[model samples]
Target chain A: MPTRIFGDIPGIPEGSEFESRVMLSHYGVHRPLQAGISGSQLEGADSIVLSGGYEDDEDLGDEIIYTGHGGRSLDTGQQVTDQQLARQNLALALNCQRGLPVRVIRGYNHRSPFSPTEGYRYDGLYRIDSYWRERGRSGFYVWRFRLVKLVTVGAPNQVDEERQTYGETRRVDVTIQRIVRNTEIALHVKELYEYQCQVCRTLVFTSAGPYAEAAHIQPLGRPHNGPDTLTNLLCLCPNHHVMFDFGGFGIANDMGLIGLDGQLHQKANHRIDRQFLAYHREHFLMNP
Target chain B: MPTRIFGDIPGIPEGSEFESRVMLSHYGVHRPLQAGISGSQLEGADSIVLSGGYEDDEDLGDEIIYTGHGGRSLDTGQQVTDQQLARQNLALALNCQRGLPVRVIRGYNHRSPFSPTEGYRYDGLYRIDSYWRERGRSGFYVWRFRLVKLVTVGAPNQVDEERQTYGETRRVDVTIQRIVRNTEIALHVKELYEYQCQVCRTLVFTSAGPYAEAAHIQPLGRPHNGPDTLTNLLCLCPNHHVMFDFGGFGIANDMGLIGLDGQLHQKANHRIDRQFLAYHREHFLMNP
Candidate 1:
């Protein structure tokens, strides 16, 4: 079933037209209403589609890479001495003492170049996990919000009798499960490499930050039986990870990266374990 | 640069609303336009967005798995006696001698469940390379079109000077080239497996037919030096191919399929080359 969100703006159909909610700056106790501002705090709303702190053309992410407030206001684009209320909202969102029920609506942004037809889609519920002041790409101090999606709490897996009677159980109730990875080790390896691909030394910049994935050299789990450790991890960009996983390349016994293209890739770091590399070679590389 | 499309629908704002172009189907001389039908030859159009013949809810592919022209027309839901113009258009699309200017758009169906914002996106210019009559998911005769995107003719290593002057070249002119795969070998392997995953013996049914992908056991290219031959190929479903690529499992020396889940998978057939398997084991699989 699809997720649901509720809130309507006058003069526009709910799921069309607008890609963002009314600016959060327009909310609070004494905001104007005629200009589409909510005069008072509209708490307990199901969802709010935030546009984020990207300048005129910036992308948003699961974790908001917020620009700091108080230097120059985005609305006015003028220098300011006092802290901005937008910054305060970030702090308020982070406050666990008064758990604010701010449900963020997720969807494709129209401001981006390749905007999709999915207007303002409601991804899921989320909460502010962390926030901090940081320097943005614009060289301005911005407040960042690290938001995490709230997973749905479901009842125990009890097959519905009606569904079973129609043979829907085989079709609809099929479940595919995967192992819960050790995010700590993964994150550590990525941080160690500073979000650059180990094989190609490439870093991809996203709306959130430089994005990189941790590849388990020897995959962790039952048949592979590889350990989830920092030594067994390689920080790589998404493309290289896919190539590595697909047997597009491998590492020699001397730690030399062997790719199909014949290009010799130097290892940027030496923390990789030879034992784990050997294990990967024996099974995945296909030549022993 | 982004691909462009043309046409206007009544209420939908141009370039915003609606998922398809109204021209391709409407332009054929004597073609019926009233109920979204064309009576005769549709020519002189640059592009088309065709939503195929799936009952109520079905997905279409670049290779159109078109149900044959008669019996229960999609337009009326009643039995069709003569050739469907929609089917005829597909045939015309496949005619290279005619070479009608037809570019197929690729995107999600607005009517299908979980459709994304990118509905009917203009992917690229394409020409119908092949066509055949096939049995569809609804047990109807369907016409299928195999379309291939036309590559642009460009001079080697020449960067646009205007883009280069502003550093826009770095941002926009970056092109990542991939090795042109040997489709003949890949297709042969897929056909050998009868479009079923060799590891699981599972066939994924699409509106067109069963779909499978070919994997290179020992990757071909400079680093891995695996060949593009039957000895190095494995037919697999998309999911299992990803698993195999990621070193999630391997074929033991004795032809045993070893996976992380420890599931005992038997090889449906036995054409695997022990030499290629040994190479894959040494380099790609990690350990013995």
Candidate 2:
């Protein structure tokens, strides 16, 4: 399991920028990809991103006065009610009272020179100077916390741009290659069937074209590793794909779909391998 | 929809080999990857692959006396009853009566000098020389069809090995790359929560490691194009991933997982983006 990160994340110095919050989450420097703050009341707040989300936020590079969560209307960003001293709001206050350090990140939206031009920038550690309840923005009581940067002895370190992009690109791009192959194979199968379900022999007619899914009789991932071959594949409508995958049915050796009364309508070139059908019957089929 | 090839595939010549049935299916040479014959009773048999599947089948380089489908025990590949003139058997008969040329592919399983060492080899087109109902060695009557090679007035053509591999590799390998990314991200999310369900807050313990699925709020491919970012991802057990994907529920902007009471039990850095939650609520959430 990944350990919870607190205060400064080692190796990642101040002013390190990430293209997306998911990248931030992957690195473990800032855990919450969406939330403004990354800490709790019990442990005291350890990290906060000043994304200029709250109207009351003030960013001055070295010093930041950030607004706490809540009180905003869901539809409109305006504060609908007075802020409460609970959840992330109280968590930030705990940091101020305990004199604990908090990691700070600034988003491009955060209207400050230190903020990233596009994504989110991780500014170094900061000490919460003070906290106070103020009534100004949107005519509602808002909790504000002042934070001062805990300056390091050396100059600000900029992470290598090439290294960060390379790592993130490899991780994210490599994921879609398999999806591409699956799509091609599936599309081919669907075209062969004219987007018709094999078992029911019904076409999912649409404006663009027809739609269908390629289901693996023995499955494709771990514990199964079913071959991505035509013999192991079945083109079906979405309903059947879901049902088959959920173990609602299985395919018999003679192309009969278990749980369904009739056999799958045949396509001359799209024959199912007996081995895969047997595999599904043994490992995946559920009682009708 | 792909038009069924009746006689010869344009580019793929005689003697071209395919490593697997899937590849053969991808190319229009033979449609039934598992079935011996690629035709219907109405359309006549267009192709036949000599895979040495029948005990009484005889293969002479220029001619093949092939056994018809059916009347064999599924558990044991033995003739258990009299083979009838139906399905592919009738289809081959139509080819003989019509004098229609049928494509012939030889598999490594076929005991003949002309068969491929491995995979399936397209030998060339053949004419049905004669067909007869004969009593087999097992004392069961079987429909046997004799095929004579319809020789092309040219040297046999072999498909370029490199070209075939390159095409097939690109098509199949590209599929799992996205799967790899999804796995990595899902694994990271599971580790973040120590393999616990965020919605139900229960740990799924296993011997090797805890299993959890990472679900996307807006989905990743096609019409939605949801980002594979952390904000759009949720770590849930299998039940939830299936239910959520099947549109069982959605997450509100405030992190409340709809259809279930209360908010999602969140980890410090594992916050879901409000945009994705809202997207799910609008698009995927089904009435509960």
Candidate 3:
């Protein structure tokens, strides 16, 4: 069956876009009213009545009205019923405590409560859960209604814009720090070795980030050149650095690298030795 | 004591730069010349000799002069010396080929060769392995040489202008094919689905090559509309692709992915599901 109902609610300011599809639930102090024909009887009904009225207003001014799902009413400043006020309170509480915005709406209507065991039935008043907000020049506004009984104490707010902003800023700061550190190390090593490894002739662009790693050729604890000095350092990849540290290889005085096993280790076969040599030859401290 | 001798040898044409020191053994033709210094008391003393004679009749008529270390002269037309020539002939006959271009000028000039008993030694002469033709007003040349005899080959040549032009042409052909294939699929699906795997978005760039794998959402055997569409395709790392193929996890219709077992059967505690979800949310794929 087709149902007609006021799409836009009154009293609540408009301009809030609908964020997500509304969820239907039972009515309570904190729960918004749900309205939908039972699945089995939906084909039988020809038309449905949607009711809207101010529970606080005893006069007949509070009355049910029928309009298409997407239709809007002329009344704009009608007072919000007690049910609508309850939903607004729930949304406010959720927003204040938690950081997620509520995405439910209360339409202008009331209907008989549905029971799971019942096959199919409808009361005179039709309860509607679907609602829309007014779209302004800039943004849209959302409207919600809650029954007072469903409202709980100290419920977390769904949205905290300020806290979210701070968290985003923190994440950005951390990323920037990582990039800066990586760049600084890469550049310093490349500059120290003049863009090539002393042991190997590996060349890199800009000598910073991803391409090189700053390494202490001699152990830092030894009484020798400063750790940061270009002479005491060599730019190498992780594998080469590990091999060099274990004394598995050494650079000869003549600038050629000597592997532990006395064999010619070409770059194709011995990656660690080749990478270290490339870095040393391309970017290393040369005697003045 | 440092002894110096100077003179010019014929046939070495002028304008060719020569190193001050050379290894006598590098001379493919003149092995006996080096023998003169070995076992001789003068081995410990630095000696220099000069070879001077030039046939003014030839275009390359400059006398090649050598100083530092002991030296000997040979006729330009003569094929080295008898002893070295014999060894060269034997090697050529055994290998069934002509000998390479080798030259000898001086001996015992720099560091002493280690492992005197071993036939192999660090000869100072650098060998030219290969060459390629280039383009333009003056074609560029690439030479690979090493400081030590063992280090025979240096770094590979970079992609020069000629190679780059060829590469661009090849790239254009491949790109056109890719564009045609992509156009056949919905453009939005390609944009919506990330090029990386929905799981462990591992993007590893290594010296060997770049790695990435494209995958299909629905198995190829399945029948459906847009089954092989771009929206159903994903580019994933190798590890993640294997996991998906084995049905370790699946993405729900609501875009939420669910995992079967706690972890992959053979793989360790690599929570593939969580990894995929994390990247999906962090990279805004879920919202996108």
**What TM value does chain A in model 1 reach?**
0.42
Candidate 2 Cα outliers beyond 4 Å, as residue runs: A1-288, B154-288
Q: Estimate each model's TM-score.
A: 0.28, 0.28, 0.18
lDDT of 1 by residue, A1-288 (tens): 122222222222222333334432222211222221121121212334433334622333333322334466568865344223243433333221112223443345434432345544433334444333333455544444444333232323221111101112212112100111244466567778887777767665421234567788776532345676777888876656654553446776676776443332334654667888776654434222
lDDT of 2 at B202: 53
In CAPRI terms, where does candidate 3 land? incorrect
| Total clashing pairs for each candidate | 59, 16, 56
Candidate 1 Cα deviation (angstroms), residue A219: 32
Model 3 Cα lDDT, one tens digit per residue, B133-239:
11112221111111111111212211111111211222322322232343334223322333333454434321112234444444332011123354455555444
Give the per-residue lDDT of model 2 (tens digit) for B107-214: 888887778789988887766754545568888877777676643332122111111121122221232233334545755777788767888775443211234567
How would you class the docking of model 2? incorrect
Looking at chain B only, the TM-scores across the models are: 0.43, 0.52, 0.24
lDDT of 3 by residue, A190-211 (tens): 5555544444444422101113
Ranking by lDDT: 2, 1, 3
lDDT of 2 at A36: 85
Global lDDT of each model? 0.42, 0.64, 0.27
**What does each candidate score in C-alpha RMSD?**
21.8, 24.0, 32.2
Each model's fraction of native contacts: 0.00, 0.00, 0.00
